[model samples]
Target: MTKSTKPAAKKPAASKAAPKSSKAVAAPAPAEANKVAKTQIIDMVASATTLSKKQAAEAVSSMLDLIATALKDGKSVGLPGLGTLSVAATAERQGVRPGTSDKITIPAGKKVRFKVASTLKGTL
Candidate 1:
């Protein structure tokens, strides 16, 4: 009788580990982002004109203050390169619960609106 050789069993391939969840990712600090944004704006202004960093900062601050004042007085302010800031009136109306259909009355209020400039609109 001839001796028969048995085939060796093959081992299963190892499974790859799952990737880390999105929650495990770290987000950038808010303060750092704010500083970067401010610096970028200042740099852009300074580069576009002869103004120094300090002058650009002051000019931006003043423009923001002016917009705030106009809104506070219920007036509209429009910026050529930025947008228009205006106060919009809302009318009181009957409202309903999104899922349950429960009826209610929504009170009228004033809201601030912004319409972007044509140049900015083109970018979007």
Candidate 2:
């Protein structure tokens, strides 16, 4: 009979499990934090404004359309509780292509900008 000469198995290295001393825990990402339902907004507007669901939807649509039109006309749109939407012109610039030293001219364009309201910023 062959005699077995094996060392006893050792416990896996201490798990990287956090030490219990620290009270801080990793926070959830901003996108995952405090999710609000679209239905809630619709319901609130319908109830508070005393408008039918269809009317509420139309009102919201009109507001958004107005904002879009203003921005298209080179005007800034500001909503008291929401934010400001504006169009900013980007200057043309030369950019280098990836994996190549060749330079390319990027055409100038107008881009929409959003500045969140101070109240909304605090909440986030």
lDDT, candidate 1, at 73: 95
> For model 1, what is the alpha-carbon lDDT of residue 3?
30
Model 2, which residues run further than 4 Å from truth?
Answer: 1-44, 98-102
Q: How good is model 1 by TM-score?
A: 0.55
lDDT of 1 by residue, 45-121 (tens): 98999999999999988877888988989999988988998999999999998999999999999899999999999
Provide TM-scores for the models.
Answer: 0.55, 0.59
Mark the 10 consecutive residues where model 2 has the least summed lDDT. 5-14
RMSD vs true structure, all candidates:
10.6, 8.2
As a whole number from 0 to 100, the lDDT of residue 107 in candidate 2 is 97
For model 2, residues 4-123, the per-residue Cα lDDT tens digits are 322222222222235432323444445555786656666778999989988887887787688889999999988898898899999999999889879999999999999999999999
lDDT of model number 1:
0.80
Clashing pairs in 1: none
lDDT computed for candidate 2: 0.77
